[model samples]
Target chain A: MLEINHLRKTFGRLVAVDDVSFTLQRGQLLGLLGPNGAGKTTTVSMIAGIATPDSGHVLIAGRALSGDTDPAKRRIGLVPQDLALYEELTARDNLRFFGALYNLAGGALDRAIGAALELVELADRRNDRVKDFSGGMKRRLNLAAGLLHDPDILLLDEPTVGVDPQSRNAIFDNLEVLKGRGKALLYTTHYMEEAERLADRIVVIDHGRVIADDTLAGLQSRVAAAGSPPANLEAVFLTLTGRSLRD
Target chain B: MPLRPLTAMVRKDLQLFFTDRRAVIMSFAVPIAIASFFGSIFSGPRGNAKPATIAVIVVDQDESTISQAVVAGLEQDRNLKVSRTAVDDARERVRRGRTSAAILIPKGFGDAAGLAFFSGQEKPALDVLFDPSHSMEVAMVRGILTAHVMQAVSAEMFGGRRGGELVDQTLAGLDSTSMPEDRRKLLRDLLGSVQTFYRQPDRSAGGTGLRGGLTMPYTVREEAMTAGTNVAYNGYAHSFAGMGIQFLLFAMANLGIEMLLERQRGLWKRLRSAPVSRLSLLAGKTVSGTIISLMTLSVSFGFAMIVFGVRIQGSLIGFLAVSTACALMAATFGLLVAAVGRTPASARGVTTLAVLMMVMLGGAWVPTFIFPAWLQQATLVVPARWAVDGLDAMTWRGIGVRGAIAPTLVLLGFAALFAGIASMRFRWEEA
Candidate 1:
C-alpha cells in the first residue's frame, strides 16, 4: 500500500535522511525501529506531507505523494508524537472538528467521532475538555483523532511516548484491530518489545539507512543460525543497529 | 468549499478566546472603561470656573449721596463684595487677603464733584487702594470706578434737558424774515436731520452694534466639506471613532495570531489532512476575524452614542459598507502577518508594532488636522488612516453615501492587496 524510493533530505551540513527505502503491503503493521536522531520522525513527516524531501518519490496507493498530495494525504492518517488536541475543546469536539476536516459531517461525522472515541475507550469522557484530561487520556484522544478520518493507511510516530502502559496496550490492541480490517500502518518506535508484539514486518533503521528488514521470527531464526541461542528481536535489533549513544 | 470545517475552526477560536479571562478583559473591558472615564471628564461645560474670590473694602468717609450710590453699584456686581470698615481695618484686610480693593471717599466728595462740574479745571478723584497680588481684581475695580464716574457725569449733563423747549428755542432763533418759503422749507429739512442725531443715544460706551460686543477673540469654526457639502464637524466624535476602529483592527490581528498558534500546535495540519481544502481554512479565519472586528466596532459605537452623544449624520448603509471594508482590511492584514511570520511571538510583535505605527500615522489617536501638513499627506499610505477618514466623512462631514464610496474602494483595495500577499506567501508548516 506504501513505497518509498531513494529518499534523501539534507539540512545545511547534515544529511538527515539518506537514500532510505521501504515498502509495506495491506493488512501489515511495519515497525520503523530507530533510536533518537535516527531520522525516523523526519521520514514520517515527509510521508505525512508536513515536510518536503530534497530528493525522493513517495508512493501511496500507486500515486506519487509529491505530485498528487491531496489524494495521497486522503489515503493516509498521521498521529504525531505530541497530542495535537485543542486543550480548550472537549474530546468529542476535537474529533468532530477533525472529522469535518475529512468531509465527514452531520450524522456520519457524529458516528465517526463516537466510534473513534469508543475504540480508544474514551467515549465516556468525550465531553470533558482536553485540558482537564490526564496524559494517557490525551494520548488516546490523539489516536482517536487520527482514526476519525478512517484513512487507508495510518502513520504513527512514537505514539506510545509518554503514555502509560495500559494506554500503550490499548493502542497496540487498536492497531491489531485496524490490521484485522485490512489497513496498512507504519508505526515507528525504539522499543523492540513493541515491534515484536505488534509489527508484522520489522524494518530496523540506523543513521538514516535501513539496516535490517524481516519478519520477527525470520530475523530471530537468522540470529539463532549464527549460534546466538535463538536470539529475540531485541538482540537482532542491537546486532543490526549497534548500541552507540545517538544524542 | 465546505463550511463545516470553517465553522468548527471559528467555534474553536471563540472557545479558546473566551476561556482566557485575561484576554477577554484586555480585549473588551479595558476599552469600555477608558471610554467611560474620558467621556465623563469631557461631559460638562467648556469653560472653567473663576479661581480668585475678590472682596472690596468700602470706607464711607463722606456718607454722601454720590458715595452711597457708588458703594451700592459695586455691591451689586458679582465680582466684588463690599465691606464697611475703617482705613486701618481695610489696609489690614487687604494684607490678610480678606479684601482685594479699598475705596476712600472724603467728606467733601459731593463738594468736589460740584466744583469739578462747574470749574472743569481740576477734576475730583477718588483714592483706590488694592493688593498687587490680585492684579485682575484691581483692574476690574478700576474699570468699575471709571464706569461709575462716566454715568454720574452723563446724568449731571443731560438728565434735566427738556426736548420740546429746546426745539422751540431753536426755531425762534432762525432768521425767517429774510427767507422765501422755499428756502424756509430747505432750512426746516436741514433742522430735521439735526433733530434725528439728537434723538439717538450717546455713542461714548463703544457700542458699535449689538453683535460687536459679542465677538470673541479667537473663534474656531469647523466646517467639514465632504464631497463638496459643508457640514458641522464634531472633533471629539471623529477622534473617538478613528481610535476605536484602529484598536479594533489591532484586536482582530491578535485573534489571527491565535490562529497561527493553532497552526503551530498541528491543529491546522490535522484539519487540512481531512477532506477540507486550504481555501476553506483561510476563508474561515478571515470570516471569523471580520465578524469579531465588526462586533467590536459596533459595541464601541454604542458606547460612543450613549456617552458622547455621537450621531451618525450620513446614510447608515454607507457607514456599514465602509465599516465592513475596514473589517475586511483588518482581517487581511492579520492574515498577511500570520503568513509571513514563522512563529506566534514574531507575528504578535510585528503585528502590534505595525498596527500601532499605522494608527499613529493614520490620525487614530490624534486628529489629522492637528498633524503637520506633510505628515497628513504621508498618512494616505496607511490603510487605517483611510478607514478613519472614511468614517469621519460619513459621520461628522455628513457626506451621505457618495462620500463613503472613495474610502470604501480604497479600503477594499487594501484588503485585496493584503489578502493577495497572504495567499501567495501562506505556508502550512514552519520554515
Candidate 2:
C-alpha cells in the first residue's frame, strides 16, 4: 500500500533519482533493483521521507506524505543502508528506544520490543551490548529496530549488505514471515540473486532511470522475445540495464 | 513534539554518556583538580587571610650596634621575611630568585652615616641588590628599609656615644671649611643644639628613638565591602566557578561532537525517518546536555566546598537561577556547534580552540580584575564571563537576587540566541 509517483531528486548539478516510480502492495515484496549508484537508495529515501524529492510525491495508504513530522511517516519503517544501532546500548534498549519513537510505551512497548527481538531470533541476546555482538548480529538487531513499531509498510535498503550467509538467510526468512502477515515491503538491492529469490515483482533501474518493471518470468519472456533467451535474472538485468560496470 | 520520543532520546544519550566510565570520571576529575590547584594558590597554604611576605636577605658588614638595630627592625616588620647571609651569598640569592632583594650594610657604614648626619654632607647609602623580575617586591622592600634605616641611624645619632664623637668632629670640621663667618656660626649653632639635644636622658620617649621616629600619620582600618553583609571572599568559590564553567563547556561541546558522530554513523537519518520532528530531537539533546553539565558543575563545587571551604554566601535561589541559566547556555552552545560543524574531527578541533579562547578571555584561569581595561571590557560579551561573575556574586560578593538577576538574564539570552541559531542552521543529515 505504498506508491512513489514520478519521483525525482537532485543534489546540486547531479540527478540522483529522475522520473522514478514504483508501487508496493500488501503481502508483496517489491525489489527496486539497480547497480551501485543507480538511485535505488535515493528512491527509497524519498519514499521513506528521509529526503525530499525535487518533484513528485509519495503516498502512504492513499494519503500524500508531506512535512518532516507527518503522521504518514509512522506507517513506514525504514531499515537504513547502514547499521544505525547505538553500540553502547543493549539490544533490548535499542529496540525500546526505537519503539518509543513511534509513541509505544509501558507494556505495549515491552511487548513490541520482545516480539521484534523474537522475530529477529535475538531474544536470548537482548541484554548484550551491540558493540559486543558480531557483524551479523548487529545487522539483525538493526532490522529488528525498524520493525519494533510494527508499521504496515517496511522499507529495507541493503539490509544484508555485509551480513554473513546465515544472518542473510535469517533476514530472508523474517521478511517472508512479514510478507505472510500482510506487510508491504520495499526491498532495494543490487544483488540479482536476492531479488530473484525474494521479490514477487522486480524493477530494474540504471543511471536514475527505470529500465524494466515486471515479474521474473515476464522479464525472461521480454529477454527471449529480444532474440536471446535469458539464463537467469542476472542475464535479464544485464540485457535490460546493460553490461557496463557501474561504479 | 511528543514527549515520549524526546524523553527516550534524552535517556539514550545519558545512558551512552554514563556508560563510558572514563569520560564520566574525567568530566568531574579535571575540573576539581584544576579548581583545587588554583584555590590553594590563591588562598595560601592554610587559607589564612595574610598577604604574601617578601623574602629578603640582609648582609650586615658593619659590626656596630646601629647596624644590628637596623637588622632587628626589619625582622620585626610583619611584611618582610629577613635572613642574614654574606654579601656574596646575598647577591647569589637575589640573582637566583631565592630572595626578592638584598639589603647590604657596608663596612664603616655606621660611622660614615653618623658623620654625614651632623655635618649635613652626602650620606652613606646602604646598597640594595634585587631580582629584576620582582620589581614590585623590590620597591616595597625599599620603602620598608628606608623607614628601618632612618630609625636606627637617627636613634644612634640622638643619644649614643657615637653621636657625641660625630658632633665634635663636625664642629672641628666647620672651622676648616671656606664659608662666610655668619654662615659658619649658623652651622655651629645647629651642631651645638644637636649636642644639647643628644645629652638629654629622656630622649628615648619623644626624640628620634625607634618607636617615635618615622611614624605614620594615619592608621588604616580595613573592612570587607559586602553591602553590609558579613561574607568574606573565598578563593575556592572563584576558582571553582572559573574551572567549573571551563570544563562544563568542554563537556557540552562533546555533546555536539556526539551529534556529529550520530550523523556520520547514520543514526540521524534513521531517527529522522521516524515521526520525530527536528525540534524534538534538538530539544532532547539540549535537555540531556544541560542535565550533564549541571551534574558536572555540582560535583566540582561540592568538592570545593568539602575540601576548600567554599560557601554560597548569597541567595540560594539566585545561585540556582544563574547555574541553571549557565547550564542551559552551554547546552544550546553544544547544539550550535553541531549545527555549524561539517564533520566530527574538524568540529572537535575548532570547538576546542573556541572553548579555550572563550574560557581564557572570560577569566577562568585568572580574575578579570587583573586583565587590561580593554580586554576586561571586551570579555563582557563572552558567556563564560557572565557565568563566572554570577557565581562570584552568589558566593563571595554576597550579592542577593538583585545582583544575580542581570547575569541570569544575560545567560538565558545567550541560551535563546544559540538555540535560535542552531534551529535555523541545523541539518537532518550531513551536507
Candidate 3:
C-alpha cells in the first residue's frame, strides 16, 4: 500500500506539486496521468524519498518516508523516467548491485535477479552489458533492476517512454504479474491507453493539482456530465484538462 | 552503514572503470606512457646513462705536501674529474670548457694560506680560472674546494690531538705585558670556548645543531650513499617523479568529472533512491578514487623503475606513506571538484585548468630550483609541490623519514581540507 498525503512542493514562486494527494491499495495499480510540467515526476520524487516535500509526506504501508534511505524506503522501488541502469555494467551486475542495496545478497539476490530477468524476458541476455543492448532491452533491464529488491510499492515513471512495442507489452505483462501477486504500483505515463489498460484507478492531475480521480467508467461519466460525452480515456483526459498544450 | 552496498557500489564503479577503455587508458596507461617518455629523455645518452662530470685541472705550483694533498682531494672526489697540468695549460683547459675550472696553487701559497686565512692578512690567492657557460658547475666546484681548503687549513692551524694544546700554547705567549687586561681576557675566553665546542661535537650535536651556533664552517663533505654513482644528479629519477605526480593529479581530478557524468545521466538518482546510506555511497566513491589513484601512481613509478632504474633511495615506509597521502589528496580533490561543479562539461573545464595550474606551479614539469625564489616559496601552497618533493626526497635526494614527515602531513591536511569543503558543498540530489 502507498499513501501520498497532500504533498506540496515549490521551487521559488512556481508550485511544482500543490496539495496533491492519492492512495493505492494492495494488488491495485494507480495510473498517474498529467501533461508536461503537471508535477508527476515531482510527486514521485517525494514518494521515492529522493526529494523533500515542502509540506505533507509520503508513506509506504503505514510508515512515512522521513528522510533519505529510511526503513520505509526499502519497501518502495522507483523506476525513474530515464533508464537508470549502468551502461558500463552487464544487466546481471546492474541487478545484483541494486539488489544488494536492500541487504539482498548471495543466493537470495541471485534468485531475485533471475526472477526479475525472467519476468522482463531478459534472462538470456542478462550477462550482456547494458550498453550493448538495444534501447528496448535497456528499458526492460531498467524495469528488472527496480524489481530486484522485491519492494511492496513500485513506482514506474514513464517506464515505457522510448521502448519498443514488444518491450512495452512485456512491461505491461510484468505489472499484471505484480498485481496478481498483491503488490501495489503507481505507473505514470503520457499514453492514455497504457493508463486505461493497466491502471485499476486513474488519477488525472493538472497544473500541480488533482483534477479527477476515478475508474475508467467513473472518469468517462464525470467528463460526460460536464457536457461532453467522452468516448474513451483520451477524450476524458482532454475534456477534464482542456485541449491546451502544456510546455 | 551496511558494507554490502558499499562494496557493491565500489565494485560497480571499478567495473565501470575497467570496462571503459578510455578511462582505463587515461588512468594508468597515460601516466606510465608520459613517465616513460620523460624517463627515457633523461635516462642517459648512448647506453652509458651517466651524468656529465665537471672537469678541473689542478696546477700544484707550490709542490708542498699541502698543495699535493689539495690536488689529490680534487682527484679523489667523483663529482669533478681532475687533471694535473701547467698553470697556462690549466687556464686554457678551463677557457675551452674541457674543465669547469682550474685550481692553480701559486708559489708559496701553502705556507702563507693558514695564518692569512684566519688572522686576516694578505696571502697568495689560489687562482681559479673558470668557464662562463658552466657557471653553476664552476660555482659548485669552487664551493667544494673552498670548503676543503677551510677544513685543511683548520687542520693545519688548530686540528689534531694537540690542536687544543696548540691554541693554549699560542695563548700562553699572548703579550699581557702590553695589551689591556680586559682585551687579553676577552680573547682568551673566546678562543677557549671555540676550542671546547669544536672538540666536543657530540655535545654540540644535542644543542643548536642546525641553528648555526658557533660551529666550524666548511665542514660540509660529500657522502656517497650509493657506491659507484657516476652521475651527480639522477635526471631519470626527477623526471619520473615529476611526470608521475602531475598525471596522477590529473587522473584523480578527472575521476570527479565521472561523478558529474553519473549525475547528468540520472544513475546517481537511482543510487540515491536505493536503501543505501549516503555515507556509504560517498565513502565508496572516495575509496574507489583513492585506490585507483594509488594504482596509477604505482604503475607509473614501477615503469620508471623497471625501464630507467629509478628506485626509492630513502625509507621505503616513508615513501609509501607519502604516496598514500598524495592519493588521498587527489581523491579528495576530485570530491571537491564534484562538489563545486554542477555539470560534467563545466567541471571538466574548471578542473582541468585548476589541476594543470597546480602541476605547473608544483614544478612537475620544470625543476622548482630553477624557479624564481618567490615563485618557489609560493608553490609551497600547492599540494602537488609536497607530492613531488615527497617522491624526490624518497628517491634521488635519499632523504630519510624526517624529510617525508612535512610532505605526508601537508598532503593529509590537504586531503582533509578538500574533503571537508566537498562534504559541505555537496548534495546527493539537488532540487
Q: How close is candidate 3 to the true structure, as a TM-score?
A: 0.74
Q: What lDDT tens digits, residue by residue, belong to model 2 across residues B1-431?
A: 78999999999989998998866976899889998899878754332456678999998899787788889999999899999999888988899999999999988888888777756676787999999999989999999998887778777776667767877888988887776799889989988987887667776556444333345556678676643545555788889999999989998898898888988888887888889888898999999999998998899988988887788888889999999999999999999999999899999999999999999998888999989899999999999999999999998787899889999999999999999999999886421
The order of the candidates by lDDT, greatest first, is 2, 3, 1
Q: In model 3, what lDDT does residue B352 have?
A: 86
Clashes of 3: 0
Instruction: Name the lDDT value of residue B14 in candidate 1.
Output: 70
Residues B306-351, model 3: lDDT tens digits? 8777768887888899999999999889889888998888888888
The sequence of per-residue lDDT tens digits that candidate 1 reaches over residues B1-431 is 66677887777667666777866665566666655554444333322434234678888787755566567667776666677889898888887877788988777674456334422434667878889898877998897776665444334222313322333344454453355678756756755654554456753443343211122235456433533443333454565666677667777777768778877776665665555566777788788778777777787777777766676888788889989999899988878877888789988888888888998788777667778899899889999888988887777667789889998999999999998898899886421
Every model's TM-score: 0.72, 0.90, 0.74
Cand. 1: chain B TM-score: 0.58
Q: What would the per-residue lDDT of candidate 1 be over residues A68-92, giving only the tens digit for each residue?
A: 2275577889888767888988898
Off by over 4 Å in 2: A218-229, A235-247, B45-51, B62-67, B108-136, B150-196, B199-201, B204-211, B225-232, B429-431
Write candidate 2's Cα lDDT for A1-247 as tens digits. 9888898888989898889888889999998888889998888888878788889878999888877788888899889888998999999889888988889999999999899989999999999999999989998898898898888999999899888899999999999999999999889887788988999999988889888889998888886755665669888888888888877
Top candidate (DockQ): 2
Cα displacement (angstroms), candidate 2, residue A154, comes to 1.3
- Give the TM-score (vs. native) of candidate 1: 0.72
Tens-place lDDT per residue, model 3, A68-117, is: 66777878888888888888788999998899888899999999999999
Pairs of colliding residues, candidate 2:
none
